[model samples]
Target: MFEYQLGIDFAKTLDKNDPLALYRNQFHIPKDDTGNDLIYLCGNSLGLQPKTTKQYVNQELEDWATLGVEGHTEARHPWLPYHEFLTESMAKVVGAKPIEVVVMNTLTANLHFMMVSFYQPTPQRYKILIEADAFPSDKYAVESQLRHHGYDDKEAVILWKARKGEELLRYEDLEQILENHGHEIALIMIGGVNYYTGQYFNLKQITNLGHKYGCKVGFDCAHGAGNVALNLHDSGADFAVWCTYKYLNSGPGSLAGAFVHERHAHSKTLNRFTGWWSHNKQTRFKMRDAFDQLPGAEGWQLSNPPILSMAAIRASLDMFNQVGIEKLIEKSKMLTGYFEFLINALKNEHIKIITPKNQEERGCQLSIQVKTADRSLHEKLTNAGIICDWREPDVIRCAPAPLYNTYQDVYNMVEKLKNILNE
Candidate 1:
């Protein structure tokens, strides 16, 4: 907390003292149709673009225009190895080693690639376990993997589900599922943070549990990559994948990240879909002879990437490196805590938080379950210049991202929620 001489103006004082407050200026915050700054609390869905992203992208455009075909080898960011430049910072953000991290295709594509290596279904252990409420894309990816392996999803996929009337996951239940059905499961692919409920699951525990059952373990870190401490390497996941377009602040539908455990780095027997990009960099230009997969995460890439998108990711990851993920997570805890405090002070039954109550169990977003559970509540918030996300059935998610959001934004959103509930 900012220890400073202050009066009752917690917001004004909080904003002035916030270490990351200056970051807000770096982003192009959205403005409503009426020309007012939208509260913009949806970073979990899509982060605001940094002003530097344009410059980074333009560098590529200029390189393409002037250098033409030479850009792959001669440009400022040399397209041939553009992904390597992002590896160090991207690795830092997710607690991975450089060799373990690679910028590659879209989220689901990366997920499938990881699955290809880690989710090797055998006759004795052929099932894949996942949280019941995982994002649809992940579900589809795994189901397809099951079908690809010549197995039926109904028999080969085990969904670790939340109990009836429960809003969050129970580690005990997950363990129980592993204890009972672990023999059938070939792999356990879980979301490090639940996209719907904003629950940050205990990754280390999940990994240990799956290993205890002799099953390979992986994580889908889509919601957790930038929002929480993933520690993918330490968590010992067989593989992990995440998108850059969300909290990472890259543009929409941008490139994704993948990580493979170091222990698996040298395994020549692991199956992978190889391409020119996956070949050893030193010999890739040779374009001949036997197929040689690069060690670690880079080995999974299938093709040359879109450098324009990689540039945006590079710009953002550099910002993350400067601010430091530990500091950002610290700020995230405080900012999200302040949001929780204000919302709880409302003491209104109409608005209920569905996210886990403990800080360790969550990140920045709070999933609000309105009593009325109507779509109009989201409409009301939208009209009031509050940018939040509404899920199917009944949940409005608001994320006060640590890099740009402030206590004042939290106050404004809570105030708007109060007015909407009153109506």
Candidate 2:
């Protein structure tokens, strides 16, 4: 824990000494109508655009304009192997081997694709277990998967609910669920970080626990990748998926990344939906060859990727490769700790933070639960030129992304909130 002090000067001093402060200039922070930079703290939802993203996307456009169909093989990055360029850097971000990572379809799509292979449910072990308050998309995906396999969705889906009056989930409760119903549970798919409370679950602990119960474990890391050192390979998870737009600073709705454990990389019996791209790269263009599946995560691909989206992803991954997740996380803890300090300093009775106090148990995001306050509090903050997100019910999720957020931004945001509350 850091001994944080009060006031603007303390924040200024922290920003002045920050080694990563200069990196904020690389992003285009949104502005108010007066043209001043807004305190953008919504990286958990949509990251601010990297200034280099335009240049990266433009390169692909130029290649298409000049070379037409030859762009697939002759472009600067070469469209045929375009997704390959992202593998190493993306793997580093998520802590996996290049062979275990692939940048492909959207987040939910990748989750379904991974489920197709990993979520094989038998009559005896056909139920799915998930966090009770999982992101809606994940809950829907699992429910649909349950229904698809001829099980009653409501009956087959098990919820790992927080104890009454609790906002965060306890591992002991999850262990209890496994103890009671582990035999019936076919898969344990959870969000690496609870999207609402911002509590980061221990991937290795969960994986080991599920495996002990003979359940395949996977994570939807949409809120974890680029925000934490997931160490997916070492976690021993069966699979994981995440989007590039948030924290990675890629453009909105850009490509997502997927991971398959190295143990399953060469398995020929894994049931997956594949296309020409998943065939042996050597014979992929033969046009008459059979579908000889490629090994590792690439074997899950169903089509050629969109070059423009991959280009934007490359632009962000290049930045991540330079800064490294370790240094970024180092700054992230300090920055978010300072945000927590300032918010707590307000001593406001109307609001309290729901995110974990332990830095190791969370990322940059802090979810503030406002007592009896509605969306109007969020609208007030927005009108004051501070941009964060409002989750349903009563939580304001503000993520001080270390790469582009500074101590000064945190200081200014809290000061504005204090004023708004006082008014």
Candidate 3:
């Protein structure tokens, strides 16, 4: 329904008609040394800081300074239930029920925690399946899980990889793997969105395939949580984990999110590591009581959270609540589609768009493979005031975040890329 043209005026026209266009101004766009706004297209790596983030975090700091010990209950947000404030909005972001979702530790840490309860392995079925290109942290976590359970890491871990000449994975291959190794596999944990190729997997499909094989299913949605409609509950995955620092726009090292399907909310038989925070809130302060596991995902908490970090997440989630993820995703498709249009229009054989072309199978990120080019191309782009990131070998990941990016930004980035490539 959209005809993409090549010009700044067309991009400006599109921006003028965009309902979320004004949201761009709500962020602090990094400026070049010359005081011009840098073309930031790295939301997949680190999102631009929301202008209100400071206010949200400072509110807590002021409460601590003024109330001291009383801040736990006397503060406006009530530190006693600080994480609860984030539950509804975060659940909305990932399309989950509040009881199924919780804001907890960092991403990899949360991944390991979820594995403890979900990755139950036995001698007959003890292998774990993951994407061949999973983020290094996930790979390490899963491998360690296998070794921790007295299995050889290399022998117990299975990689669902792309075909010999392909970069994207196919479900047929996964089905084949399960058909053969189904009995031997204990868990299937893959990135909901592939970090390097920007491919969005079908979570429900993966979960179904794993369940059919009698293996537990999980996803690391660090890239998909805020960027797509995850529908974690409907997907019926056993659990999922993701961080807030990316599209969620929380600060660096901010608290991550976790999801446990409602079916497992009160599964007392499931093994889990817990702390006082996971105890029943009503009697938590009693000090000398037996452990009463709080039902749902909240029971996974190991400690009282970092309020300052959680405050930043609260700020970002509030914006997400106002705009809604579905609306943001609609804009994301248009923004990233426009980005793809311009890249293809270049027709430069030296550059290839490695990410999937189908909007339904990808997020805002476009992983561009600069054929035969090295890090020098990335350096030149950085010098030209573009804030995209360079992955090792030959890919540059650029994401036009719907919350704070414009059509004009996409147009300008492509124009700059064209000029650089022509030179």
Give TM-scores for every candidate, taking all chains together and pairing residue i with residue i: 0.97, 0.99, 0.99
TM-score between candidate 1 and the true structure: 0.97
- For TM-score, candidate 1 versus 2, the one ahead is 2
Instruction: Write one digit per residue (lDDT tens) for candidate 2, span 279-374.
Output: 999999898987898999999998999999999999889999998999999999999999999999999999899999999999999999988889
Name the lDDT of candidate 1.
0.89
- lDDT of each prediction vs. the true structure? 0.89, 0.95, 0.94
Which regions of candidate 1 deviate over 4 angstroms? 1-8
Report the lDDT tens digits of candidate 3 across residue range 1-423: 788888888899999999998898889999999899999999998988999999999999999999997999999999989999999999999999999999999999999999999999987999999999999999999999998999999999999999998899999999999999999999999999999999999999999989998999999999998999999999999999999999999988888999999999989999998899999999999999999999999999989899999999998999999999999999999999999999999999988998999999999999999888889999999999899999988999999999999998989998888899889
**Which residue ranges in model 2 land beyond 4 Å of their true spot?**
none
**After aligning candidate 2 to the native by TM-score, how far in Å is the CA of 289 from where it should be?**
1.5
lDDT for residue 284 in candidate 1, whole number 0-100: 85
